[model samples]
Target: MKKKFLVMSDSHGQNDLVQEVIDKESPIDGLIHCGDMEEAFGKDLSFPMYFVKGNCDSRRIGKKIPYERIIDVCGYKILICHGHLYHVKYSLQDLINEGISQQVDIICFGHTHIPLITKKKGILLLNPGSLAFPERGYQNSYIVLTFSENGIHYSLKEVMEY
Candidate 1:
């Protein structure tokens, strides 16, 4: 089976773009929000969403999001988190080490509002960036990931409209 996932985070209540992205790109099997959504996932959400609380989040949704979870996505083990807890930008080495310890195939996190799709020590580490305030020099963006038995496939989509 193929597992398609919509990965995002840090909306801070601005959901128009996010909602548009999901609606236009339907049939997503899972949604991962790396926190700071202001708890939008609990409301107006109709997908299987897994979220984590960011520093800006008024509600600690990550607690309910089942932290440190190992999800099986088409035989791939995915580890998801908000990234702030792992000190994302400053140091991803710790996060990578932890992922290795947990034996996960992919690790996802968001905090610096910078999207990334890179590998460290053979493990995939990704950050979908901040959707609401992406004006921090880079285009507002998100990611779509297709996990397969062979590997994970993905693409980046930019939010061109306000």
Candidate 2:
């Protein structure tokens, strides 16, 4: 069976945008939010959702959510984080080290508000950017991971704001 997951981050309190994405991408097997949500948005979701607390998130929310999470999907181990804890704006060494230590196949994070997809030391690094406040010269974007018997495939997608 094929499984699909929508990966997003840094919504920053824009629940409308998050809803739009969910509406447009319905029927997904799961959703992964890399953080900076600024609000709890998964209460009504019908599918499985994973989340981490961002530096901008409130203390109360932070108390409920973790700073990092490791999840297994379709036999692939994925690390989800907000990036601020690892100082991603400065470098990815810490995050990479963590992924390696966790033996994850992919690491998803957000903080720089810049979308990125790259492979480092055989682990895929993905950042979905900011849905509400993208960095200069970058568009609002997210990622989709499709897992099948063949393998895993990923696509970086731009949010189509109407």
| lDDT (tens digit, per residue) of candidate 2 on 1-162 | 899999999998888998888888777999999998998884577789898989988563658688989999989999999999899999999999999999999999999999999999999999999988999999999898899999989998899867
lDDT of 2: 0.91
Could you tell me the TM-score of candidate 2? 0.96
Badly placed stretches (over 4 Å) of model 2 are 60-62
Which segments of candidate 1 are over 4 A away from where they belong? 42-46, 58-63, 66-68
How well is each residue in 23-127 modelled by candidate 1, as lDDT tens digits?
877888888877778755445555687776678774544455544456777777888887777777798988999999999999978878888899999898878
TM for every model, in the order presented, reads 0.88, 0.96
lDDT of each: 0.78, 0.91
Provide the lDDT at 92 for model 2. 98
